[model samples]
Target chain A: MAETRQWRLASRPTGEPTRENFDLVTVDRPEPGPGEVLVKTLYQSVDPYMRGRMRDEESYAEPWDVGDPMQAGIVGEVVQSEADDFDEGDVVTGNLLWAEHAVADADELRPVNPELGPVSTALGVLGMPGITGYFGMLDVADPSPGETVVVSAAAGAVGSVAGQIARLSGARVVGTAGSEEKIDWLTDELGFDAAINYKETDDLEAAVAEACPDGVDAYFDNVGGPITDAVWPLLNVDARVAVCGQISLYNETEVPTGPRKLSKLIESRARVEGFLVGDYQSRWGEALESLSEFIQQDDLHYRENVVDGFENAPDAFLGLFEGENIGKQLVKVAERGE
Target chain B: MAETRQWRLASRPTGEPTRENFDLVTVDRPEPGPGEVLVKTLYQSVDPYMRGRMRDEESYAEPWDVGDPMQAGIVGEVVQSEADDFDEGDVVTGNLLWAEHAVADADELRPVNPELGPVSTALGVLGMPGITGYFGMLDVADPSPGETVVVSAAAGAVGSVAGQIARLSGARVVGTAGSEEKIDWLTDELGFDAAINYKETDDLEAAVAEACPDGVDAYFDNVGGPITDAVWPLLNVDARVAVCGQISLYNETEVPTGPRKLSKLIESRARVEGFLVGDYQSRWGEALESLSEFIQQDDLHYRENVVDGFENAPDAFLGLFEGENIGKQLVKVAERGE
Candidate 1:
């Protein structure tokens, strides 16, 4: 038996998360049962959406109980295996724990192809966030050629992929970020037509309008709040808005109040639909295949903000709320087994 | 030439409309030229949607320019025709002015088949409101059999038809209306599974939840504001909302704010789509043919809140904001040609 150091929910967060919300503990790692593989975490994803799961309520993801280890998107090496599909030293990815070692059923793990790109990319642009952007943009917000597509949280894992995909679809892509670095990355690197640093803009609506001169035709909304309020009025006739996430309101202890917009929707004949990437479980292959092609062709770009050491997982997770990460925020637990 | 008594926009209204916003003008009736017909106005629809047009901004319906006669769905009779399609004394329906008489291009008019039902139905169940209800219910908020469907403004022209159509689809129909009279009409006359007088109810959310034990599968929203805010949480997984009208907010002077809801939509994977009846112009024949069949079979019921005389057209239009009308609000301008 080996030792596993893991992060657990010490308390449910109030308002915004603090370091006191989590506890890092070491435990005796157990042996794998039949049809299971012992995965040693190399990289684990930290996302803003995990904030919602901390609450004691039913949501898209199940709530986390106090004192229980939190689960997240993890890319790991198979240190030991009792399953036929995975060999020792094979790199795999699945929804796993923020621990150094996790016992997962072989069926739940997907083999990460190092031949495609870095194995860590599986936890970022080639995983749930990427799939979310793909399905939400293509299925829900179906932007047309020459139309303006606006994405919020544009430097984050999902929005970066969404904006690039919209640009690839022959639409002009506009994005809102929090820093000048993110703005530069979105416009200079990712080929975004316009990138607005919301923290720097005084009148967000005016900034969005100036960026989208013809008004927004499609909107990929990830951080809903005042940002969404600003985008509502600028929607052109027959616009499409895909509600992918509402990270801004995830930690609010009380209900948020803002402008009512059904009247705006009616006049524009627009559509606002909420979607989850899990809904396309049958089409994961299709999404990954296309996403892999984009990466190979150098059309899609990705960045990973890594925090070394497994014990620092909670800090990495908490950093998401402060907009500390430029792209996918991940905590590295160990080196990959060769 | 006959002197035509008509109402024109005196000024763009600020806040709620008043008498000062309109002017009653008497002008010499103009003659129809090539490809036109002279129609003697019989009935003119006065709806809540007209309030949006009274503003000076572009909307689904173009803004009514100050000092110009406003147009609506009018059931009229052709007195004289210069076009080959129309004959004298033929009852027709088209978008026409609020006047004693107006000339219209023949291609813009659809001859009302009075042999099927009363001529007044051309302004209610056989007109734009009916088609709006039809496509909105069937195409957007597609409720399955045994599913629960809730409609706001249930006693209004569009909502009334929407409920009946949902009932015809074999779904459980619930409605929210203003008065006890309207509630009874929805439950007893229109065959809604449950009806709530939103004005009378203290806890609307509880009432709606009790009525829909399985949660709402589809929502046909006509009145937006607190009424819609109540139905947001009761939505089931994959719920669909057809944003047909927002009569409740049409009179709002400033930006209206309430609890934000994009988070709830994301959790439920629900869809809210705003649609205009004009978008389905190509499918009008299909809608009318099915709607006419419903009328002939007595499966659908409709009511007209008729304000006698063309002189009271402004009063009828304003009454909609006061929630005075039960169903289609129309001013009877004249008798059909003998």
Candidate 2:
């Protein structure tokens, strides 16, 4: 029997998750069943949304039970297959176990096109996060030319792409991030009109006001806390808000409280919609096609912070709350054809 | 010159408005200018939205400055006209001053059809409040058949009509109001599936949850505070919230704070939109036509709480915050030919 290392949920976190909540163990790599492919893991994604799954409550995504094998977006190479669609050494990606090796139904896996860019992008810019930002910005927010758009957590994988998409639509884009490096990446590299280092600013509302002088016509919200509280009052008439993620409030054990905002909506006649990328599943091809063209033409840029070893997956996920990664955070579990 | 009694703002209120905030004075009735008509006030509207205008800050409607004549929806008989569109004794409705008489541009006034129930219906069921509910329910919320729709302040003018519209569309309707009479009016009179007396309920969330076993698919929000906070978590997937009024929070001296709701929106993929009746001006004829048909066919019912004197107009407006009126709150200023 082939041996594999798997990460499992040792326990659920009360507030912020730590390494103690995860357990790593070696187990036999199970044989592929009919229409299943045995994949050797290359890279696995760590995202803010996974924090919700750690809780024992029902959310958009199903909750992760204690002692169950953890699952996430995994980019891997097919080592063996009982499925006709894949063969040895073929790179693919799917939502799979966070392990050195795992078997997935062939129908669930998508063949990675190395021609598009690096295979690692199958878990980053060319994958779920990229599509999430694409549909969230273009469909939900729908910023028009010359309008002002603001994106919170703007240097992260989704925010960076969403902000650039707004800029491409001819809107004046402003972004907010925690660190100066992330701020620089947004304004200097991502073509954002302005970027606010929220950690360094005493008053985020005033900083946002200075950046968005015309008021925010569209807002792509990733972090919902004081940053959103600040943006709520500055919404222009008929403003559109895409509630993409609330990374700021995800870890709080208690229901968080903030300033009442629905009153501001009436004053501005604004529309605030919460959406999941899976809602646009039928049109994901449209997002990928556009994203690919933009990347080909050098209009869209992406970055990754790849942490090595399958044993370090929990730490990479924990780092997301600390704002430790500049872009898509990933764990490089193994080399292809290992 | 003939005299008319007018109400003016005495000063902006720090919290809840009081009788001292209004000054009633007798002034000479003004003559009609070009394209203007001098209207003799019959019924003046005292609504929850008027509270927003009393504040010093700008809102969807321009704020009324101290010493300026308070303005509201007025149904009156045109005593004098300098325009070809209106004739003397023709009842008309417009956003006009709260007084015995006021002059308005003929273009701004709509002719009131006395045959469509009572002329005061121009200020209640057949007018702004009616159209507001029509568009907010059918358009913004867009409740479909078999969906669960929840309405707050459900016995109020806009909410009564909105809930009925949802019921007419074949959705299961639930309402929340302050009094048992209002609850009875909602479930018994307005055809709501369930009604919760929020004032009587100790656990509003549990009450809402119990009423909506399948969860809420649409919400018509008239009063935003604890009622809204309770309903937020009970939203089903893809719920729609039409934010028409936040009467509960209108008089707060400072910005009110409550449990954060955007996270719940993400869980349900719900859409929260704020809308004003004025935005649907072009389609008002469509709304009024449909509403008139519904009324004529005995499918729609309306009620009015007439406070029988103009001297008590401020009291009528103040009573809205206390949830005093059963239906549309109106001040009967004078007889049609007084």
Candidate 3:
């Protein structure tokens, strides 16, 4: 039997997840069944939303049970195939096990186009995070020309793209990030009109007010805590808020309390909508096409912070909460098979 | 010159407004200017939204400065007119001063149809509250047939109509109110599938869950405090929440802190929107026509807690915070002209 290394959930974290919550073990590599393809992992995605699946709570993502193999979006090369659509050596991407080798249904996997960009982008800018930001900004928030748009956690994979999309629409874009490097990346590289280093600022509201002098017409919320509380009161009348992620509250054992904001929504007549990228599955092709064109034209830029080795996957996931990654955080599990 | 009694803001309330915040004074009845009409107040609206105007903070409704005459939706008889649209003894409704008489541009006033039930319906079922519920339910939190719709403050003017409208759309309607009478009015009178007396219930979430077994698909939020917190977790996938009023939080001296809910919205992919009736001005005729048809067909029932005298208008307005009125709260100032 062929042996494969895999990561499994050792236990659920009470608050913030640690390296101890994950386990690495070698197991017998199962052969592909009918219509299944055995894939050798190249890169796997680590996202803020994955924090939600670690807990027992019912959320949009299914919770991972203790002692179970962890799963994530992975771009890999097909080593063996029982499916007619996939052949050995084909590079494909799908939600798969965090392992050196795993079998997935061929139907679930998408063929990665290396021609569009780097194959690693299949798990970053050209993948789930990119589509999430694309639909969330252009469709949900729908910022207009000359309007002010603010994006929280703006140097992260999703927020970075969301802000740039708003800027492309001719909106004045403002972004908030934790570090000075992230702030500079948002303003200098991403074409954001302004960026606020929230960790350095004593008053985020005043900082945001200085950045968004016209008031926020559209807000892409990724971290929902004091940053969101500050932005809530500054929303212009008829503001549109795209509630894509609440990475700030994901690790809290207890539901955190904050200033009641529905009253402010009424004052601004704001529309706050929570959405998942999977909901726009039918229209994802539209996003991928636009994102690829923007990338090829040098209009859209993306960053990847890749951690080498399958054993380090937990560290990369844990680092997300510590603000360690600048953009899409990924784990390079193995080299692509020939 | 004839004198008319008017109520002015004595001082901005720090917390809950009191009778002392109002100063009743006799002032000379204002004369009509060109394109203006002098309207004698007959039925003055005392609504929960008026509490927002009393604050010094900026809101959708213009804040009343200290000693400024308090203004609200008023159904009155035109005593004099300098415009071609209105004449003496013509019953009209407009956002007018809370007094025996005040001057308003003829363009701002809408002619009241006495044949459409009582003329006071112009301030209750056939007016702003009716129109608010109409659009908020039909347009914002649009419940599909067989979907579960939950309405908080379900016996109040906007809520009562909102609940009934959801019921009319073939949705399984649930409501929450303060009193058993209000509960009875919701379930028994307004055709709600279930009604929870929030004042009597120890666990509002459990009560809401029991009432909406399939989970809440739509929520018409009139009071946003504990009731909203309870309903937030029960939202089904793609639920819509129409935030019309936060009467529960309106009286708080400071912004109240509660369990953060944006995360729950992400779990359900729900959309929460805050809207004002004034924004739908161009299409109000559509609401009025539909509301009138529903009222005349006995498909919609309305209640009025008319405080008999204008001297008690402050009391009527104050009572809204206490959940005193079952339906519309109005102050009947005078009889229609002979």
Candidate 4:
């Protein structure tokens, strides 16, 4: 490859991120060194968490430096390799550049099989979001049989898988989302017992209360803020909440305030915990196995909102906050043999 | 017994409770019925949680009826018995009335020994607060050696013991209190690494950060609201917070609002759990055994702010919110053998 088109961080965002904060640039594609593979990007994952990386301040993940090409969970095919770990035709997925072609260490590239599922799925249900939903629901939330589990941002990548996993645990699943389409996708297609269109609902607490008559036993919180506040009063005794993501607060310039629910937690003897998929790195194979099984058995349904072309990648990332995607949001950078 | 002096619920208070909410009355001593025993009150425990009972609303515990005498965890003597289980003169502690004399089901009373420590301790260290600290600190928070543990309301009955327990686990204990005397007791007597008089501290978060330089690993929270708001930002990765009580908000007429820290939990991957001592009913014996050993070995010290007369029971209970009591607040209805 002569040139690699990439989206680089132009500046740190103040409030909600904009296109001006990113710059599209073309750089000469470097040759693969020893123990490295050159890959042509097939699909690129865009997630809400990437917003945190755009800030200059320190957070859980390191800030993406200004003028650096942004990195994402990109699935690509190896076009050139100098390592025994990969062949020229091998399909791989890893944390790589948001570009048409990039060089990565062979060890960083995880091989993906096109025989098992669609190649693009390695960026969504078969990858980070899937494993995140897997561990967070089963290990963190730990919902039991017949218990009511409520999930926020239900049609999103992590939340969608989390709700499905809760159902597999014999628990009643209720989901909250922004659109009727997402709500339908959750309840009608994904097997959630109830789905509340939070954007349309005037009284969120009442909607949640009606959906979870028995009170929420477990909560998979993907979008925090008001959604979590609504879930507070309805928590059953010993309720467990897994804080997966807080996309609602991610774009906010000022810290938001609300009715503090520590007292309510005490009254209910409930628990709220936060987690990141990266923390469960050691046990990912276990999660991937279960997620793959669920997908192969048709027990887990997957969806994606893919934006076409490398030029539209930044918009694909920004669309997360606007509730523009139904499931995992991704960008298609190139053809299979580009 | 000729007369039993008692405090009955006169009216429910809207905000902070007042003495006018209670009515002191003299009644004829009650006699034991079948399967019951007549108890003459000795040490009467007054806790912040009792404030919730005074409200005529649906909560975790049943609301105290307006016409009935306010009940509490009372240590008393069995004066007369119709039940074979409790011998006359046996020192017992149970959920009993504010009156000096009342009938209790034999099953309600738990036996306490004067030989192990002062029978008054059954109202403080060897009782509910002790078990609350035991389970909240050890079981829920689960602080490890070399970790920093912060306990709010750290001079109170539960918080003091919880901080001590964390210290016993080899964690550096940071305590927050309201009085200089209580601060002295926590740091000098109880071996707390640092104590902040939250009332005098201009910047609570800064003070907490200074006290817990390594960041908070475990937090035993008895006082919630702003004190908790300060601790949220200082949480280390995988921190455990035991929400034992929200004494600060117990009297709030409206739900108090503050910076929502749910997003911070996600960033730190921390866990906050609430618990009542009653939830560990099956494990009371284990807690008691550990508590007694801590006291017997002189590893633990206890303090009680004793109100000398039955007339002051309501005052003692009200003093909790004002930070009047240094340790366990109790009303001494009569002499031990009265």
Candidate 5:
């Protein structure tokens, strides 16, 4: 019998998620059923949206029930397979969890080949987050050549990939980040046209105007708050806004006050929209293929903030709110057996 | 020489407009130029947008210069014509002012025949405000047959007409107004599916949900603020928002805050857009013709709040902010000569 640990939802959070909200319990791993594979967990992703799922409230995704195991994107190696597709020693990735081992139907698990890049990349750039950035940026915003595209949280996993893909598509890309170092990475390393350090800037609207002189043609919004309020007025006529996340406002008990200038969107004749990545599931392959080509061409760059040990998973997840993690947040629970 | 009395901009107000913001001055009427006609002003229109014009700040239309005559849509008779398009005793309407008499270029005015409908209809359902509602609701939002459409200020000029047109196009029409009386008028008289009195409702979101059982498919937004915040979450997938005005926040010095949940827009895949009537100038004839046909078929209804004097124009204009006017605000400054 194999050993496994499961992180279960202990309690619903009121504001910021706490350690008390989750519990780790070790148990004997179950044998795989027919047409299923038992995966030995190698890496688990810690995402901001996991905070939303921990709450007993309605969201774009189903909320985690109290006393149920907390779920997230995970990469693992197939140890035992009763499935025709997945074989022993095959690496796989899926929406598994913070578990040492998990059993899922073969159809739900995607085989991960190291030849595609690093195995952890399956849970980061070449996975759901990468596909989200690629498809949402291209399909929702639909930027034209030379059009200015501004993204928020630019150094984060989704925004970084989104900006690079936008640049590859011939857009003039700008971004906003929480720290100066992230700003440097966005502008100097990631090839963003301009990167605004939102923490240092007193006036976000002025910074946006300076970066996008002709006005932003497309806005890939990840952090919706004062930053979005500032960008709303500066959008050109017919500009498209893709609302992927509102990380900054997620923890706030009250909505922030500013210009209430939603009417300005009418004046600019701009379209503000929201989207979920799951809606594009059928077309995800196109995103993966394009993102892979970009990565191979040296056109896209990604950073992984890999935390060691299952106990430190909470730290990595909490680091997202403080902007401590430079890229995708992940936890390596155990070494993979080749 | 003919006697003429003009209402001019006396001063710009800090917040709410006052009687002191306007000056009624009597001036000696001048002769018409080569292509001009001497018009004896009869019916002068007062609209919410005119309040914006009184300020010395820029808006969609240029601000009224300090001490200059206040301009608005006026119905008059051509007392004298120096151009072939107009003759003596012809009824005309154009951007005139709260004056007993004036001189205008023949090219700037449109001839209105009483055979079409009451001349007051021009300012209500057949003029700028009407055509504004027409083009905005039809061309911009494009509410299809059997779709659910909601309009704010349902008993007011633009909104009242917009709802009927939406109904004529086979939409389930819901509306919001300031009072129960107005709400009754919208639902009982105008044939709207439902109406919500925003002032009486504590939970606007719940009220809107009850009124619009199915999510809102199209929104003709004349009032922006809490009403907009309520409507945001109820928007269906592929929902269209035609931002006509933000009457609720127009007088506000700051932006109102609720829940900054714009990210929800992405989850619903809705589009919130802003627009100006002038931007659709090329489609004016089509809208005007269709609106005229609707009125001719008795498929549309409109109301007008006619203030008696040119001297009272400032009061009538300021009343818009207080939600005092029932429908189109117009000033019958002079008796018709025809």
Candidate 6:
């Protein structure tokens, strides 16, 4: 029997989930049953959306049950396989949990090869965030050549890829980040035409107007709040808005409110739509393929801040709200195929 | 020279416009020059959007200059014509003003035949309001047969036509109104499957949920604010929202702020689009033809609250915010010219 530690949801958090909200307990691991594979967790992705799952409220994904291990996107290596689909030492990435090991059905995980770059890449660029960025802007924003596409949270995992992809499609890309460092990275490294550090800016509306002189043709919104309000008036006629996430308001004790900008949508003849990645489950293959190509060609660049322990997962998760991570935030639980 | 009473923008209002905001004065009407016609205003449509134009602030249309005649959609008769396109005694509809008479370019006015029902129908059903209802729903909501469609301000001009159009397309229509009388009119006269007086309901979310058990497939939003917040969660997957107007928040001294719900958009795969009739400029012929057919066949019904006398126009316009009008609010300054 092997020892494993599982992080369970202790209680729903009022605001940000503290260490008290999660309980770490060690338990003996059982042998894999028929049609299942036991995977040793390697890398776990921490995202802004995971904060939403901490609440017992209804959302796109089911709420995490109290006393159960918190689920997350993880890359791991199979240690033992009772199913013929996966063998020992096979690398896999899927929605598992923040744990040392997970026993999942053979059909639950997809095999990943680190030869593509790094095992953690499967959790970021070639993973959920990558697919989210690829499909959303292409399928929803659908920017025409020479059109201006603006994205908020630009230096983050999804926004970074979205801006680059839009640029590749011949659209001018403008992005907004929280800090000057992130803005520089977005403009110089991620291929964004321009970037604005929203934190330092006094007038968001003026900043956006200056960055996008022609007005925003398409907007990929990730951090919705006053920033979104600023972007509202700048949207051109027939503009498309892909509402990815509202990380800015996710951890509030109450609903974070802003000016009702629904009227702006009508004034601009614009469209604002919210979409979950799960909605594109059938079309994920197409997204993955295009993203993989873009990555292979170096057209899209992804950065991951690796915190070296499973115990540090909570910090990494909390850092997402503070805008600490440069791109994708991930936690390496243990060595793979050990 | 003929005498004309013109209504001009006296001042911008902080919230709702008052009688003092409009200045009506009689002046000598200029003769129709080449390619222009002298129109005798019979009916001037009072819309919620005209309030937005009174301010010098930037909007879809340029703001009305101080002391300039406040423009609105009007149905008038050509008492004199100087262009080859129009002739004397021609009944026309144009984006005109609240005046007894005015000179306009022939190209700016469209001939309205009384054969298409009463000429006033040109101002309500066969004009901008009708086209707004038709295109806003068809292009944005795209409701499927047997799907549940909900609309706000359902007894008003746009909402009434939108609900009826959705019903004719095989959608079960649910509507929300501000008063009990409006609710009755919506359910009985407009053929809505269900109607709720939002003013009477303490819990809008629960009320909307009960009325739309399968969830709303399409939402024609005329009044956005707290009512929209209530309807947001009840939207089914891939629900379409056509944001026509946000009348509830329009008169606010400051922007009505609330929790940013950009994240909720992803949960429902919902789309909220703002649109103007100008976007459908090229498609007006198609919409007008279809709406005309619906009216001719008696498949669509519209009611108008016509206020008599040009001097009472300011009062009638101001009555919109008080919910005094039954349907389309119009000021009848003179009889329709045959």
Alpha carbon lDDT of each predicted model: 0.91, 0.92, 0.91, 0.91, 0.85, 0.87
List of clashing residue pairs for candidate 5: A259-B255, A260-B255, A266-B274, A266-B275, A274-B265, A274-B266, A275-B266
RMSD of each: 1.5, 1.0, 1.3, 1.3, 2.4, 1.8
- What level of docking quality does candidate 3 show? high
Candidate 5's displacement at residue A297, Å, is 2.2
Pitting candidate 1 against candidate 2, the one with the higher TM-score is 2
lDDT by residue for model 1 (B34-137), tens: 99999999999987888988988887788998999999889999998999999999999999998989999999999997787878888898898888899999
Candidate 6: residue B248 lDDT (0-100):
87
Q: What is the alpha-carbon lDDT of model 2 when measured against the actual structure? A: 0.92
Write the residue-wise lDDT of candidate 4 on B90-174 in tens digits. 9999999888888999999999887887888888888999889989999999999999999999999998899999999999999
Q: Name the regions of candidate 4 deviating beyond 4 angstroms.
A: none
| Residue A336, candidate 4: alpha-carbon lDDT | 85
Q: How many collisions between residues are there in candidate 4?
A: 0
Instruction: For candidate 1, list the clashing residue pairs, or say none.
Output: none
- CAPRI quality of model 4: high
The TM-score, computed over Cα atoms with residue i paired to residue i, of candidate 4 is: 0.98
Instruction: Kindly list the per-residue Cα lDDT of model 5 for residues B169-205, writing each as its tens digit.
Output: 8999999999888988898888999999999999999
Q: Chain A TM-score, candidate 5?
A: 0.97
Docking class of 1: high
List, residue by residue over B79-162, the lDDT tens digit for candidate 6. Answer: 989999998888999987778888899999988987767888888888888889998888888888999999988888888888
- The C-alpha local distance difference test score for the whole of candidate 1 amounts to 0.91
Report how far off residue A1 is in candidate 3 (Å): 3.0
Ranking by TM-score: 2, 4, 3, 1, 6, 5
Rank order (by lDDT, best first): 2, 3, 1, 4, 6, 5
Q: Kindly report which residue pairs in candidate 3 clash with one another.
A: none
Candidate 5 lDDT score at position B137: 86
